[model samples]
Target: MQHLETMPRGLPKAVKKCLEKSRDSALLAVETYNKPAIKFKSGGYIVLMVISWTALFHAIFFRQKKKPFYKKNNRFEKKDGDYCYWELSTCVSKYFVADTNNPIRKNLEFFIPLRNMVEHKSIPEIDSDIFAECQAMLLNYDKIMLKEFGNKYCLRESLSFALQLYPSSKSLNNAIIANPSTKPIVDFIKAYRSGITTDIMNSGEYSFKAFLIQVANHQTKNTLPIQFVAYDKLDDTQKTNVNRVAALVKNKFVQVPVTNKDLLKPSVVVKKVQTALGNPKINKNGKEKDKFNMDTHTRCWKKYQVRPENGNENPELTKPEYCVYDQPNDTYLYTEDWSDYLIEEMAKEDEYNSLYE
Candidate 1:
């Protein structure tokens, strides 16, 4: 509960400013998120948290870089003229020694796509659906903040439990049914969660697990207001039996809808692009060749960085959200959305110059 009433004089000014901003933004985010009056705008809370966390990382990177923190062509910069100091995603990759499965990274991945989707659109169910992840995000922030700065700078005490609104199976079910417009959000959440491993999904650091308890009113003021009894607080049998409570929340959401017919193979993707682009041809190595061939499609995929790299063996890659990998057939699966993206990107070059003219 140490208060940073004033910026310590000895520390670098940039580091101080960045850390201060980060702390402020984090507090604002949690405050905004928990306030029911502005529940509709709670998605903005994630954006703020991202900004705050990004700044905190930048401060760390800057401190680690020390004297040359502002020097040109450092790891934080792309070129002499191009700087990536303020970019969150780039900073995470450069500073944090984390993998794709890291809890912080995983949580960020969930939020990043979500933030993109709900940027302008008022997705009503986002706050309710992402409750666990949002709780974990704040918890992670405080832990990392303490680890990075020190216990003195941690904000754990400032954050309290976000009391459950409806903490029973029937209530939760009714809430889901009443909010039918959230179907798309529910589908996206399921598709994304389905792609992640069970360990990651079940990890409290990745997504906080809340077990609803009906507490009796305390007449004595000396009784604890709210207590966080960790797993260790429970005996071995209780620990093993906790699965019963977890089952209450597990697989309760709508499963991702299966659309088995729309998937297309690489050859089909190429053919579709070629037909859409007027079946044009280009001069290859001493010979004229179809411009929209498999090679061309491969080049396009790499250029645009279509995620879940083609032919990746990761089981999650075949989830049919972005693309699916057929195990037995040994082929990559793509959808109509991917086809449209390819055609749209290829059309910009417009190999058939006559059409633009």
Candidate 2:
């Protein structure tokens, strides 16, 4: 599924530390729950079941309707992106709760029952490993929840702007090793946590760019699979050649009139060897051929021009010039790759780096 494509990678240090702490807490919950712990009687297990099931359902169906600013009817509508990020944040919170009334507690309440059915479902097959790990994952979610919410601090996007100091000072491995209980959940959370803060520096633009390209590639593959006119199946070299030729025939989108005139110049010219043994002579009238369409002059010309004082209609102007009033009012056309956007991004990166450097 597109939604499950990639988790964030190259995490900020704070997220890494949060992951470690949450992970350790998860392993502790699992170890404690799995062992007939010193406490947590039959009633406690029932409480765990309800909480886990509720959490599981919430994660599975986290979608909800929210009002957006730009609707004509001014109605609230469902948006997947918001739900996904918030739910994931909730999933992280499920690992860190110290008391009741935590939403993450409710999430756990929802998850645990399904986990029991999944693990102990005898008439059919059961997967103890997934069930066990998911339970641990949910526990880690509690740790994040408890740290942020238990003390009256909600760790959702609402507080994302407020957390200036993150846990970057602490080493994730050290935190895990010190805690000892959360190695597995810590590792798992850290793995999923990569995409967590591409939003930290808020540079999801790069991620979003790659995402759009992948989406375009998928759409193209589905609607316009490659077709070769000359060759049924081209080797890599042939494909490269076709691509180059396609690039060569593209029309330029120059805004300046002089530059457009310069581009209109013949890219190539051929001369016949009229005199093999004698000196060459420039032809009085050389016929241009092949490089571009002959009608290019008509298409590129500005519709209106000035008249000469002496009754010469097309005097003085050596090249066809364009005027703002001559062009079609609403005509729009599409061509070219998004390399301009990419180039601008690279320029911004360079500028930012230069500023720091």
Candidate 3:
């Protein structure tokens, strides 16, 4: 384990302290999650890792001689007589200010809200469903540590592949069915996933998904029992071989819910946008009238390019976060994010005017 004494010499005192605390918190998070006896692993790990990430960002800011504390009226905000520090979400926003769509930032954003939702509840059934995101969060932490500091502070040397019993698809399903209370969390996960672009959804930095296949015994006993190969780093031939192997062992345990239970039609989307925006009015031909309607909805989708036009040969090409093509209905369905996005954007006079212009 990297210790305070081993940290780079002549570093700022605040940076050193934050780095040490961050490292310890991350190590504890991994230890907590890997404990075989612990059933509620996700809850503990998320709380600790959020702290770890916040501290790591604090360390980076401190190294650059920047204060990460919240400010009120140009003065540091105080909580219980102590300065209030920026939370993980704020830290991410500050650090990645220039790149809002960064997959790493998205990964952290996913956990920030999730940590709150799971704080007062126990939803162990979600562990397998969100394992990819959890794994990416930890890996992204180590990556940032290496980039900001050096290999000396990296967590790779201190961590190992966690031992695990192969999961049973039937048992996991039964557990989820038994815990009906987890519906909200499960729905949130699905909704959040549906709102992201396919590239971000597939990005390893956002969610590290992999297949663990058993291979034949090595010719030499000195070989490691497990090895991690980067899919992107592989050559074309190697990638093809990996793909073949993955296809052979891949099993679909849980299917994505594709029913139209939550999908909103255009009229419903317009109503949602109107209500969400407080039913604001606009002047049409010198008289007051409803601001948003089907025409506005059509304009919004066209302006945002959420989906192809009605007669377009390829209708499925859409920004999944807001819109999706429903083949059976020969129409585009909208997600909750679509209305929410319209509410936010069209709230501005300039954006609302642009849709018409």
Candidate 4:
């Protein structure tokens, strides 16, 4: 700083003055923002940095400027006041404020009378009836919207309700087609409710049940809830898994294959378990004359795969050859019991002795 001061002036006086002006302008930009008076004023006037206070006060507050807030509607009377009331009344009438058909535009002419009565010094006080109308108008709008849309969208499990209403109708929306084509339903319903797509299904973003209810009434005009088709068909264990999956997601209405139509086929379970198990000939290859032995196949099948209950087919484990027991001890035990391990070891010993002889 001392060196800068001591250095000979590098330019003529005019140039130095220009540099000083530039520096002063830059410093003033920051310094004024931190000034105490500008920060503390509580008047209605907002502080702005574009102009100096002396200029801003003269231009903004002293001038008493008011820009137009609404466009003049030609149908209304020839005054801004007439249009202002019309707009407010229109908003209220269309909302939960009144019956769906209340005459909002007609009421625009009356707000002037209402405002003038109590507010202006010479005007008479507003009647209690006039005051009550405005108050009631404000209260009913929220009640109306909530009741109208909120009640319509509850999701139903059975296609019976939706099938009655959708698909065949030409105007059906994509949301109503809650089939595999319209996405997994759970994800779409969630996005509709929370207005956010999320990985965490139940992260307090939106309630799944609430979302389905909305979709049933508003968004998914044609589709039924995913769960209703065959909930009764799920065994207790499968039902429990469905409940667990529902609890983890943002929306509980998953297209979980709970119905017999949706339940994973035995072949699907076999394929999945086969990858986890050594390729034991548990299920017979299609058209292979001999099916896999029952004791070995059932033992292997039960370890990794669950048997489908009731009307489901599991030909791999159910074939007659698949039921054979080499040594019958109990009626159920063939080659599958704990004793099979002991018995097999003894058989190996006998074979080894025969070869040695």
Candidate 5:
């Protein structure tokens, strides 16, 4: 085994360590993803990729601001212990200006959930379906690395596309379609693709698009293979063809927009939570009170500490509103996101009861 040590000679120790760790995680993610024989390599890739991004942001925070990236919590206090810092997602969401729309955020949305799923169970051989995302992950990593550090430390030249044994796209598609084992993987890809915006789905920057076309012979020995022409760079005829293909694909996987208007009433939110918990109702003060009822939701509003009840008094309490209260209507309008959160939490409670109660 090769001897290894972190050398924080010239740079700040935290910054150096974070950068090194990020690069190591990214390289390992790519390597694990490429090895087809590796079981659940996708999970390894996603976990490491997320760690890489988290560490990257940590390094950036230290390098730019010259302070520790983590935040302190009074709960974890000890005489000699250090304060806890934010995780990658929290750091990015809290500090990063690219929260609205960026390749890094877009890529993370997919990989983070994937990391969660794969942590619970093994994912079958379906990495090829998300080839674009995997490719973009590395690309975005290098882009950020170059921007944060410099061209001297860029890893672009060190990496290349993983060579596949079977280049037949038709055969691969057919196999995925026919195989029972791959059904969940296909469904996941389609569902994920359909949820995003048209531009995001098509953006090569967000997810690198590569069309595998068969070629008979090379034009020249010196001329490099694997030509990638952007949609804007294409000629009129080529652009028309690309548009047609995009339309066809879009039609098949219709995009479902997730808007705030899909928000649920407090009653709906209560019903969902109650149903998820499988709790019918309980007698309370000569009236039926659901175990996961409006009161429960009210408690959740206080517990989760996201939606502010007194937005009118202290608007700062609802800085980022997940639920809006309509004073005129005298009702709380909880977002679909809030409803989902409640349901997930309720389900977890139910599972805990079933397991331990």
Candidate 6:
């Protein structure tokens, strides 16, 4: 990573300042996380990393000659006479506008709400549970920095593996059990994880999961003590070998049958959407009526093709994110995302009217 003092003189003034602040913030985040004395590792790390990411996005936008501030009435919004810059969420939206399901974006999104949840409270129990996403966030930050500003701005060299004692298998569970106040945070984490697709959950770009196996020291004294192998980059034979080794230490997981508690009926979805939209009323057949009803929901499902019509031969064909087929009941169930999508799309006058067309 390039030191701030060594930054190129030719770089734009605003971009240089943003980049310098970003790099410093990132370094501070890593320092805080790696410090053995710090008990609030996750909270401190997240707060600093959020600032780092926001500033990094600002630097990128500035490099492209674009302002990264909110505008209203052709004027930049100001706070205390200084221009208000975009937040991390806004930056992510603008940067990845074309791809909503990007794993890197998902990882960042996970932390945005999490940061808020932990702001006023200490929840160190979550550190181990969210390690994968936290690692991926830092890696993604450095990767983007390198891509945008070349090798000179990379953070790889400045960081080292955080030393740690091995944790007991039930440490995370025990921590949460001991702290009843952590239930809300735990629930939030689980709900967020449940909402995302399995593919995104497993994506290394979304969350970096790995096994650290202890092996005998190499013959060469100077050989590196640790190395990271990219599981996705490995050949099939190599993967099989790794899996065989992993099996010896893998924890046995008992499968539990899933319940349909999260799956909502069509009526429930309609009610949720209507309530979310302030229960707007419209004229239907010359009488005032709820604008978003069963018919509207039916039109939405048909228009989005989130699920097949009733009595279709392929009853299981449904979008997992928005809708799912309940085989035993032979009915389509909706997800919270479905209602949220409706609330957003229907909130628009044009989009709501298009349901009729």
Name the top TM-score candidate: 3
lDDT of 4 by residue, 1-357 (tens): 112233246433433332333223323433432343442211111111112221211222212332112344634344645432223323334332444323222222223222222232221111111222232222222223134323221111111222211111111122234333323222222222222123322321111121122233536656535433243478999979767665654344333221111222223333433433333342345544212233334444344232322234442243222232111111121112322332333235453234324
Error of 5 at 73 (Å): 5.5
| After superposition, candidate 2 runs with Cα above 4 Å error | 1-74, 77-124, 151-357
**Alpha carbon lDDT of each predicted model:** 0.67, 0.30, 0.84, 0.28, 0.65, 0.84
What's the ranking of the predictions by lDDT, best on top?
Answer: 3, 6, 1, 5, 2, 4
What is candidate 1's TM-score against the reference?
Answer: 0.62
Better of 2 and 4 by lDDT: 2
Please give, for residues 219-260, the per-residue lDDT of candidate 2 as tens digits: 444564332143326798986976665555332321111111
TM-score, candidate 2, is 0.17
**lDDT (Cα, tens digit) per residue for candidate 1, span 1-357:** 222448556567777878888888898888877776784555778888888888788788767864323335545545677553546666656655557678777777677666766666565455655677888888888888888788767787677766557632332223358676655555456556655666888787788866655679899989877777676479988987876666654646323234234566678788998899898888868998887788777666555555456455564444345465543234456778888777877787754233334
lDDT, residue 198, candidate 3: 69
- Candidate achieving higher lDDT, 5 or 6: 6
lDDT of 3 by residue, 1-357 (tens): 757888769888899999999999999999999998887799999999999999999999999999999999999999999989999989998999989789998899889888988888887787877888999999999999999999988899999999888853433334459798876666556556655566888899999988887779999999999987888999999999988877666644334334244667788889988888899887889998778989999999998899998899999899988886755236677988888899999889899888766
Tens digits of per-residue lDDT for model 6 on 43-63?
A: 999999999999999999999
Pitting candidate 4 against candidate 6, the one with the higher TM-score is 6
lDDT of 3: 0.84
* Better model by lDDT: candidate 2 vs candidate 6: 6
Q: For model 4, state the Cα shift of residue 153 in Å.
A: 19
Between candidates 2 and 6, the one scoring higher on TM-score is: 6
Model 6 residue 14 CA deviation in Å: 0.9
State which candidate, 2 or 3, has the greater lDDT. 3
Worst 10 residues of 5 by lDDT: 1-10
